[model samples]
Target: MNEYLPLATLLRLLAVLTLTLAPHVGHLPPWVSALIAGLIVWRGLTAYRQWRMPGTMVKIALALLAFVGVLVHFDGRLGGQNAGTTLLCVMTALKLLEFKGRRDVMVLIFLMYFMLLTHFLFSQEMWTVAYLFVCVLAVTAVLIECQHRGALSPRITLRKGGIMVLQALPLMVLLFVLFPRIPGPLWGLPEDSAAARSGLPDQMAPGDISRLIESDEVAFRVEFHGPVPPPSARYWRGPVFDHFDGRAWRDSVPTFASGLSSRLELLGEPVSYAIMLESQRGRWLFALDMPAARSLPDDAFIGREGQLLARKPVTERRRYELTSYMQYRLAPELDEHARKRYLRLPPDFNPRTRTLAATLRTHYTDDEALVTAVLRMFHEQPFVYTLRPPPLGRHSVDEFLFDTRRGFCEHYAGAFSFLMRAAGIPARVVTGYQGGQHNVFGDYYVVRQSDAHAWAEVWIENRGWVRVDPTAAVSPQRIEQSIEAALDAAEGLPGHLAARTRLRFYLEARWEWLNGRWNALVLSYGPELQQRFLERLGLDDLRDTILALTVLGTSILAFMGVLTLRQFAPEPVRDAALREWQRLTRRLARAGLPQRPGEGPRDYAARVAAVHPEWAQAIHHITQLYVRMRYLDDPDPAGQNALVDAVRAFKPRSARRRSWIRS
Candidate 1:
């Protein structure tokens, strides 16, 4: 009935709570983090100093203040995922101040569990899962400590908690495998669930993709069914930008043309592959160039411009299979409206570049020849392919083409597209990823943000849209090798993309392979996959599947229940000295001097000595030796043997004989 809590127990709870809240520190507001930290410290101090609990009015005021803070920080919106997580954290911190006894601690521990679940809302990566597992173990240990009748050592409590977790593992696996998964995610994802992801945007400008090149995050990973595509053929298509506004290139209104199949002509043999795409929070699904219509995923379709797109934004890691051809003709016959759309440019920008385009056009009467000339010029000129390019003026393409002459892929693609449009060639800039690093250990290609690229797609008379990469003309290494090889040694690259020692490379490759397996085998286990697995097990019918799940689930629960009950089962006597001591106690009980419950050896021995004064010396000696051997820090083996010998030698008469002697 006591409302008091031990300091050690309180501190253990705080430690676990801190562990649960650590991952949110990166995304939670700084003020919220500080408030939580302050509250935690104050709670610890209150427990240590035995301070009174916060008054009800004070708790109410604190709650209101936290609500206001969340509202103000989130710009008056509290319904979104971020706002909700922040509020949950705030409420948890507030709860810490009033933590008094068993009820409050239970509430706090449950809150910790809920907060731990919130992390998966942001990221469900392999590392995130591992971290959450550790947090769960720690929190479980603290919970066990709370229920214990007496204080338990941290090691003992953790061991017991781990045993419980191990016992439940079978049930967990059964539920995960047999639970009838619905289509898509288990729950509706909040709007902001995919916030803070990085990849190619819906638009591209001079520095947009170049900046993306600095990030080493994987855009997607591909496992080719047959031979892997060559480096030059590894252009994963994303958003196509046809509308140029001088400074930026934006995607035109998408027309999911009914005649798309008629327009696209596949030339070369198709390359089939499966892509495990990371969340980019955009509708554009990157696939190899010119994805075939037949092999497209059920939820995705090829856009009017030949780029693959999802029906909805990819808010989680997704796996999809597709067939694409390196050689293909998209929109073989361009209509007037589409032609005008691709060629339209701002009237007053890049005058010098336009003039140069005109002069090149004049020299080469044929459009293909003009395109060849531009690429040749890029190859012959002093244009440097570098990550750190000089800033451009208002006429960005003009500056890059005439003055600076050094830029990343986006700059080259933008200038090339502008010149093609200027010279009266229908052209547009296509932004996506170019080269990917093959994770040899996993036998998959990892396309990263650093591989993000922009190239010009110009329409020709018979070829339809021809892919022209001006950057490749300047530096072939970028296409043939990697971004690291493309740039000079002095130009900085992301740490993961940079060169590493052989040992480090090996470790990283193994880790990446593990991650790939986790993603493919675990995170990508959706409803369809579950159904396939169940069908393999001959549980095709819904009723059969549910019945199997129930039977297996009940069996696991019953097994775990038996294991748990065994832990509480009384232990059998094992030690020789203890067995002899028990025999002595039995003899005393027969003589009507039974050892009571919770009686210690010394106390029992003293009471028996009082009952039989003649045997006091022998009883005291036995009890002293037993107590020393059983309870002392370092009792000798000799002492244990001595206690056993002395208890065995001690003899007592029955109660009737003792009473006769006393009479």
Candidate 2:
């Protein structure tokens, strides 16, 4: 089949394969991409130049080399998602070298489809969906071209394939609406499902969140039931860190005590909203500060430290509804053990910070007053709020507070928490996102990784856990507006979050709104949503749903099958000129001057004119008219009419009459 395969068709296949494999280039190893590219070029050259394919030994050597390369690149484990995808890509490229038969082409096409499916493992955004659709259409067109006995125009082939896909849309919709949806993703490897996501970490050090501030990736999106909380109150709580080990703060083992409800005091009007949280691959979930215990997601609870957590890591995008109180008191009465736990700090670290805390404590004996004094110091001093803070030494808090006043939210929060602990106050660092950008077009807020923040949560005698953002004291604009506004002009914001011109901002807003709609309407369709939709459609019973699905699905398929058959069914003769030409040929055949099988109108006319010289002029005239009207580009309308009229009026002479004329 390789010998007979058209260069055009081979090129088409290669083009589709390239499109299918392009998205993976970012994640696949550089060598793999380079190798695949080289092989594709080699295949194209081999087809075009008619070069011989690699020998069996050469093929074996290439395969073994690829195998070894993949094994070495993946640390000898070929079982995981990355390894398997790499192997598939390499094998697909290798398959190009041995394009022996139609079966091989079919195998390659199927592999392309599989590769296209793997794209969803990384992203299911609207652009990805549209790209995959185009790739599918291209692949389908190539598949159709492969089955043709003769060359067809690329446009015609593509149109036919597109028609087939459009005809199948009804069935696709039926299946999508009625098919039973599993709880999680339909296709994914558990081990690598959340590997590509970036968000808050469980631990917070001097620059942990400051580094996060550089990423534009979305952490989650929130659609509030009412007005969104003010910027100062929009602290999406994530992990709570009570254990500060010198340079970093880490979360203690979450205590799922039954008395969590008793410890949390809900106040003010409850803010009802739903969060479409992106996968962070962590057990902790983020909600507005002080999420109510009663309004928690299933298999999730508020930890003793007031951090919302789930039983399992968020391996996929999850939408959960919760009611949180912007104003709430937590753990009003702190026990001795808990107080000590929150106050504990690594010894012999940040001696200067400890000394400063002791000095501030003597000045202001009242805990609340002392807190205010530290905040005042931060506000009055020349502490700079910047993303590019200098590197911290072993005494990070000490250095940030004294030596270099430049630091991010984490730095300020860490120093404040350390000072509070040293001054005999129960204080801990609370890490989460602080501010969200509102997408007015979508009526939702987009919380990005850039919004990741840390603040001090001090346990006052009667106030319980109070939120204290020392960074706000240093740079109040960070809390009031966005990080973009808070940072100096010298500091750059994430690409997506950077300020834009009015037109560009509008365009970005529209695009984000479209993506939000896609996520809500398409990606959020899970088992529970499917059930609700079916119920609304009066498909309450499982049997009824299945029955309806089967019936509707079969009907759609049957309709599509009939349409397909009609499309492939032979077309009737419709051209008047061609019909007249056929009639003329039939008349000649009856006179025993039949047109030979492989004879064109001109050739048959020439043969007849030679046989009967008396009819030569007339035969030549008819042939000329027919050829011009039938074959030439945009023949004159008068010429077509003349051919039809001439064929109708002219009658051929019989063999006897021709012989008589000859004698």
Candidate 3:
């Protein structure tokens, strides 16, 4: 067994296994990856040294330790996606320790294929898919090597495996195109599978938005049916926080007022657009401030605060069509409940901010005049729009407004909302994404986490809740251009933005465009898209889809059958001596005496000679030449030719039926 399975084959299998498990490292626990690496190193060393494999008891003990470690690490919750995947990965690595035979190798290869699929559960990005494909090819090559006899090179195995994969492409494409597309599970994934998203949070603390500002990960993508909205107008509203607890601004009871059909008195022509929202693991959806969608999914609805919310958390990419009026009035007739909530603030939170608001209130008579005064103060104040800001004391808003005066959008929005509430005007902090980069190639706006912005919305007597962004006052360029443009040249950008040359930036933008295409064309392919695709194929309904699938599947099978027949067709024996020897045996059977089954040439010849002694010399001589040519190696071509000639020329007469056959 050791002789058959070479060190090179083992190393190649280990290399492929490493690639299959590499992507999982980031998702699984750190110890899991480390343990896997350690096991691989140990296995490789053992194979290189030709050492005896681990015994059954040792392998069983190690497996138990791995199982216990996984359970303890995940706190005994071994059912969900991450936990199950971690356990599978740990066990798979341990399987390498007891690599006994071909059966064990086959099991590992099958498990590796399953592990590759789990990677898509975490991320379906184009780069990840491409990387997984490479891993698949490598694993397939190792599988081929397992079945193959003799010492073949890795390159040959890889070539054969690649050919096999290419041949399977036709069937894969047929299945992908014709397969019935169904929606995801109605109940959604397991609770633990729905990992927390990294974008906006429902609760906004002092440095929540600041921390998000560093991330370049996309929040969602929007494709405008008409003109793309200007950066100033693209305020995708998310969570509305009216309850302030001195340190963090939180959502009030009214914020959860979704599932209720509320009509908005839209004033202007609605901007029709489709938003491909990334799963944020929360119900809150981002849209224009005054959004009005004709038909929302059963799980989704527009909240009373004009915020979109889902009945359940979003665990997959959701593409919903919405018509939003950038210039529209929302909740003009404000109720007392909402009014009181917006104006409600902790009593002893920020004394100085309240005093300043009072002074401004005394100076400005009307609500509009007070709003203008507040805007003027924000514009005139030396408030720096920076990600890093000085830590605030208990009075966060007062410290930010009076002392620190340096913070991100959260600080400005919090301070402005406090000033509004202090001046007796109902206000709330609106947290959502601000500007988005418009991709020229794909014609979609990519809103990123760094674009996350917070602003205050004040409800006046007649105008309702007016959108106000104090960050714009401090850094207008942040809205007009981008976050990078707004940051000071001396302060520098984060890793994603910093050290990016023009060429690198261009390449990155192009890569984003490709990723956007993948998201739209591949990942977004669901029931509706499948139906549309079927319509093109004249398979509109379920009956038609099934029929078409049957026809195509049958056609594929028929074609495969023909290829299979061609692949395994019998070929004539190329050995001249063997072919001639087979002919000699047939001629002897034509006589009265025939060779019995499982009879060797030497035995058969002796039996034939006893029955017909007249051909004894020829039979004995032929058997000797045949055995030497067939069983033993003969380099002389003339020797094989002589054997063939002798067998064909020697025609033995039948012992008893020769005269009767002649008559």
Candidate 4:
């Protein structure tokens, strides 16, 4: 089997296989990728040394071992993207060992194509898509070489392959535009598609959000149809934690009291916008604080505490239109269940913080006054807003409030919520992004994970859950400006956000704008966009779309076929001359005057003349001219013209006699 494959083809196949597996390294188990690399190295060495391949039994044993390893590593769950991709990768590596002939190469190449598709399951970023396209081109070149029987120059093969891809681009674009797209997932998404992203977690531990502040990954991007909201009003609400354990805050089972309709009264014109959210592998959707009651996406619902909840986990780039009113009230008249839930706090925790809350309650008569007193305390006290805050013990709130008055937004929000609850006011922590950077190039706001924030929402008798940002009191710049502007210059921000040069910053913004457009126009192209595209072509329903597609497809196919035939078809006069020469040789062979291999035209003509003396002069003249025109370096144009005439005029006398006898 190995004898059939040339060394060049084997090397090319190995190169393509190596590159195809490179992108999956980060997603696959470390050992799996490492095993692949080792196998590739061994295969290359074997090919170079002309060593014998492993036996079938040995290959089988190795494959079984790899399969067992995958099962063990993936917890015996041979389902979804992770396990399935791992299995694919393992089997692909094993396939290299069993490489025999062209059939195996074809099978290997098809597997490579499938592996290329799996790459998009994990990432659809601009760079990722570009990388996959380049891989496709290389794989296509290998496929072209496999089909070619004769040796072709590397440059020529690559050029022809590239041309083929370029030729297909227009048709591909047409299909993408006219194809009937299925809404949402036509098939179940692989579990590996969902990854852990740097966003608000379901539960907030002491330093949970502080860890997220360091990451500059964009959580989402928002484009306003009307006007961009002010930074102070841009509170993108996420998870509302009602259940407070001793150490952390988590959402608990909803009670009827918490579910009571707050009947939010809109004060002004709603701000309409569309958000392109990055997948967070969770159901929570980030919306501006105080969103309209019914302004959520079709797949989303407003939770009891006014947080947007998606029906399914967000495993892809999701675009949803939303209208939010920054100024609105909910549950102004706090219900009993709501009071019990929001104000409920674990006993035997944060004794010192509770004492201070009691002290503040005695000093202030009303709930509003108590809230103001807490804000004043945060402002007057030496509460340093820093990313690198001292770690707290079990009593996180007490330690932050008294001992270490240095913390992030979570610290401030947690302490504030604790004080409010201790002072007999219903309060809970609301976690989400606070501010976003406005990209002038894109005309949209980019909210990064660094903008992740938390603040207190204390329930007032007359005024529902009033948003109290204690971090603002401690550091007003954080609310007004960005995380970088708020933090000291000594603690540099993540490299992407903190550009060293003005030109670099401008280029970054431009690239980001291009990526934003790519996501919206390309990645977000779904059934609705496809339908709208067809509507522009006067094709409305599925039936019309199919009909129009059939017509367009047939026309494209016919045009392509015509182009192909034209490329392969010969030139008229040149083809006729060559065809006549071949026919004369066949006639001579039939008359027992056949030319022998390596016999020069002059030698063959002499032999033919000896056998049939009647055509001697004609044969001699034609053979002399044919030799001088084709083989000799004669610049005279008359040689070619005379050779064509001599060949057309010459006729084998023996064949003519046979034809005459038959007549």
In model 1, state the lDDT of residue 361: 81
**Reference-based TM-score of each model:** 0.84, 0.84, 0.83, 0.83
* lDDT digits (tens) for residues 1-663 of candidate 2: 245568888887888899999998987999999999999999988889989988999999999999999999988888767888889899999998789688888899888888898888788899998999998899899889988756668899899889877877788888888888876666556465544368787688877897787787778889999877899999998888889888788867654433577888889999999998887767778999878877898779887777788876777677899999999888899888888888898889999988998998889999999999999999999899888888988888888889999988988998899999999999998888888888988889999888899998898998899999998998889999988788756477666567667898888779888887887778877777788889999999789999999899888888777876897888877886787788888888887789899998889998988876767777788888877777875767788788877876676756447687979
Instruction: Estimate, for each residue in 1-663, the C-alpha lDDT of model 4 and write its tens digit.
Output: 254456787688789888888988888999999999999889878888888999989998999999999999989888877898889988998898888777888899999989998887677789987887778888888888888765566787688778787778768887877778766554566545544445688888778998887686779999999988889889999888878898888888741122323556666778999999887767778898767757777777777777888776775667888998888887678768868877888999999988998888888989998899889889998889888889889888988888989888988888888889988999998999998888999899999888999998988878887899999999888898877777855366666556547898778779889989998888778776676667888998989888877888888878888988998887665543344455567778877778798886678888888877777888877766666565665536576667667766766755578777989
Name model 4 segments beyond 4 Å from true.
149-151, 190-192, 195-198, 254-262, 498-500, 572-663
Segments in model 2 whose C-alpha atoms lie over 4 Å from true places: 188-191, 194-196, 255-259, 568-663
What's each prediction's clash count? 0, 0, 0, 0
Q: Any residue pairs clashing in model 1, and if so which?
A: none
C-alpha RMSD by candidate, in order = 7.9, 8.7, 7.6, 6.5
Clashing pairs in 4: none
lDDT of 4 at 44: 78
lDDT of 2: 0.84
Model 3 is weakest, by summed lDDT over 10 consecutive residues, at 185-194
lDDT of 1 by residue, 100-125 (tens): 76888899999998899899878888
In order, the Cα lDDT scores of the candidates are: 0.84, 0.84, 0.82, 0.81
Q: After superposition, how far is residue 25 of candidate 2 from its true place, in Å?
A: 1.2
TM-score of 4: 0.83
